[model samples]
Target: MRILHIIHSIDPRSGGPSHALRGLVQEQVRRGHQVSILTTNAQSAEPWMPDDQFRERMNNDPAFSGAELFIARGYGRTRPVARFTWTPQAYRWLRRRLADLDARPDIVHIHGVFSHLTTFAPRLARRFGVPYIMRPAGTFAPRCMALGRTAMKRWFTTLFVAKDLRLAAAVQATTPAEKDELREQFGLNNVVVIPHGVAGVKDAQTDAPAARRALNIPERAKVLLYLSRLTPKKRPDWVIQAASKLLSEYPDLFTIFAGPDAGAESQLAAAIASSGLNGQVKRFGFVTGDQKRQLFEAADVLVLPSQSENFGVVVVEAMAHRLPVVVTPGVASHIYVDASGCGLTVEDSVDALTDGIKKILQADKTELGQRGREYVRQHLTWIVVSEKISEVYAAIIRNQRTRRRNRSVNQQIRLTTK
Candidate 1:
């Protein structure tokens, strides 16, 4: 099937939604489907998501990067983030591109269109008379609003944006929690819960000692890595508090917070200082590409303390690296962690996270890592996700065919009666 993915930025550090799109595109192309991405990233003098290695790899990949790169202009001159979530160029580009394309797509799958790329794309897809699927990627959920800490943006979304999502043929959720969040809190009228997942790396094992040395990690210290954007939603404070508690009990524990500071960097930095963990906490500002993989390799466990996560994609990535994960209980990834025993699940608290890290330290790291890999292999591979997506696309096409047939039969009956 010919599929066009509408995304805000092709930049990888922009996070999971972008990563998921590129991965699926690669797989689809391998399966002999023509996959194209329409985005609104103009020629920036400086790298917009400079810290993202995944974005770098995707940009350089022989298969993925060779695809068309549509750069559009938008309203994000003043702030770094405004460029991503408020770019107005995305919708306009999608509308014009649809008209200009030589062959119409079987489906136009939209990802993260509500931010940076602008909000106009979904409405344009509706106008083109093509069935477009919106993957809010957990942006429209109640949890997202709380995480974002912006009541006004939440209100605007409820009034103007969510209706656009409802207008789409269907919305995609990465997990069951997200699906429920969409229906219950977001009042989503049409939705499908297809796991936005990752495949375990082939021979993903690494030279742990080398990775440690590159990161300057001490051999005696147990590495605790939190790799994601430094944001309030990520609840980095929980990790900091946990670190303070572990300092006395586990003196050799090294707490590393590595990722771009999207909005909450200063706040997290402040917390780290106030906690008086001057020597213990290591802030790597941001990591991408190979640096990211190496950090994962050096770590004993990955910690995601998100108060609200649709599906923590990094949980699977950590598993791929054969690292155990410690995640918040309410997240969609928690379901995977709890069921698979690949990692420990903790409640939303300082002591809870602290205990989780302590418990993880007790377990056999090798066994935990193996379990994590097994979990991803069973529940979250690209092949499994592709099959699910193909089923949804086929279902929509079949439904359209039935509706056309019914309309034709009614016309024939009217002619015969006349």
Candidate 2:
């Protein structure tokens, strides 16, 4: 069967969404399925988007040669970008290319609903009589709108998102929390919960001492690793104040905030200084591959402490590496950890985060990390996620075929009666 996946951009720093897409496309190709991707992020003769626009490069990109890549982009800054995603020029460009759509596709799986690729492509899928799947990721969260920095999205959704969401053959959710959110937001009941999986790195976990040595962390220093972006909605200030309170108690403990600094790095520095927690806080900016794995391995505990998170892919990634996690209240997996005893979840406040961190520091790392990795191995992984997604695609394709056949029969019957 022919399958097409659509996304607006391939920026790796965009994080899990692009990674998940790459993994899915690769697995489908491995399974001998015809898969292609339509992205507004294509490189024309001289690259489509400006060199500065793409903050990160997508490595081992499955969208490269095998997939039929079509480029698309929204003009202007990312904040007010959703309007540009569905601009008349982009819409016309897409319609023209889709006129010669490669295989007419059995299904189109859309990632990031607000992007140019999804905004216009879904309408095309609908017009071409194909099923389209919507994966909003965490964009449906209210705080997403707050962070989207867009008053335009509110109006855009009323016009496009609402209709596109309903017309979608099914909405793909990464967790039950997201499915519920979708149902509440758009009255969209046709939602499927299919959480993402991380392909874990073997021997990723490093002993605290060795990790500290590698990172130049002083001997006897305890590390609390925050392995994600420095973004406003993540509330890194909570982590800072929390670490400040725990500082005296855990004499050796130091906070390592790592990840690409989109905007919050200086704010974090200022917060740490104003809170009188200087020197105790260290910012590594962004570290991936070996550094990322070693940092997680070396930490005493993994702190997410997000105000609003969809699934917290980092939480599960930490689990896969057998690191105990302390997530903030709004993360979707907080309840899972709370129920399963995998780790702790608390409100996004300095006091609560501090307490949770201390609790994790005291917990049995061997047992807890072992349990966490076991649970992740049993439940999460790309193979399982891909299988579930495959099922969704198959069901959609089958339904479409059945509908076409039924319509044909009815047309024949009407003609006979005439």
Candidate 3:
């Protein structure tokens, strides 16, 4: 099958959606399907482009070798002065390009919503009578709209997104929580639950001591890592507070908050200093690629106290590394962790987070980490996810063919009756 993915941006720091796209494309390519990506050339002031380590991995990683990227200029910013990812020129170019393709895509997979692509891509698919799937990437959840943008969202949905979503062959959500949110908001029953997949990292399997040496993490210190975007929604401050609470008991505990600071680093630093958790809490803004793998290996445990996470990609990444996780109520994977005994799920509070951390530390950590690793290997790898996604694509195409066949038969019957 020939598949084309349309996303606002491919920058990894754009968050889970971008990474999820990479995983899906890699798996699809490995499965012998032709896959290509159409993405915006949006560059945020912050770093998201692959660093030296990531470039090296991409060069050697066979999964990434076949996935091709076509970058076009885009405009419009989610934040003031950020990269323009939804430009008019890009939208026009895409429409023209799709029209001109010699071999039209079997399926057009659109990722992210409330962007120019979201508004335009689906219309093009409908115009060409091509089946397309829309993955909102958790944008429809209530928490995502609660930041004083409800009115604009409602207006946008009514005018543009609603028609596209209703006309879509399928709508995909990465978690059950997201599926529910979409159903409630859109009253649509077509939502399918499909979680994002993680590519296995061999560096994650490296010995902890060696990994620590590589990352310059002291072997004696029990590292608690917070790996995600430094955004207000992620509640990075909560991790700092939780670490403060555990400092008395585990004096050697060192917590590092790493990831691209999406305008939240200053506040996080302020909180760390005010709590006098300066030494214990360090903000290593934006680590990715091999640096990300080494950090995962060096860490004893991972914490993501998010206010709302449709699906926590970093959680599974940590799990894949054989590291236990501490996720808050907002994370959709809380239920999985609770059921698998891989980690603890706590409320989105400092006290609860602190207790959850303590519990994981006291338990058989090695066993817990192993359970996490096994869980990811069995259920969350790209190979497994891609297989399911392929089924979705095949079903959509088959249904389309059936509908067309029925129409043709009906026309023939009418001619005979006449």
Superposed on all Cα atoms, the candidates' RMSDs to the truth, in angstroms, are 3.5, 3.6, 3.1
Q: Candidate 3: where is the Cα deviation over 4 Å? A: 44-64, 77-84, 201-205, 416-418
Candidate 1 residue spans exceeding 4 A from truth: 42-63, 79-92, 113-118, 147-151, 186-189, 274-278, 412-418
Q: Which tens-of-lDDT digit does each residue in 299-321 have in candidate 2?
A: 87889878788877788888888
Which of candidates 1 and 2 is the stronger one according to TM-score? 2
Q: Which is the winner by TM-score between candidate 1 and candidate 3?
A: 3
Q: List, residue by residue over 163-276, the lDDT tens digit for candidate 3.
A: 888889999998888888888888888889989889864433457888778867678888899998888999888888888888889888888888888777888888788776
Sorting all predicted structures by lDDT, with the top scorer first, yields 3, 1, 2
lDDT of 1 at 284: 85
* Among all candidates shown, the one with the greatest lDDT: 3
Q: Model 2 reaches what TM-score against the true structure?
A: 0.89
> What are the lDDT figures for the candidates, one per model?
0.75, 0.75, 0.80
Q: Model 2 residue 29 lDDT? A: 77
lDDT (C-alpha) at residue 2 in model 2 = 82
- Among all windows of 10 consecutive residues in model 1, the one with the lowest summed lDDT is 42-51
Question: Least accurate stretch of 10 residues (summed lDDT) in model 3?
Answer: 76-85
Best by the TM-score measure:
3
Candidate 1 local lDDT, residue 170: 86
Give the CA lDDT, 0 to 100, for residue 403 in model 2: 95
All candidates in order of TM-score, best leading? 3, 2, 1
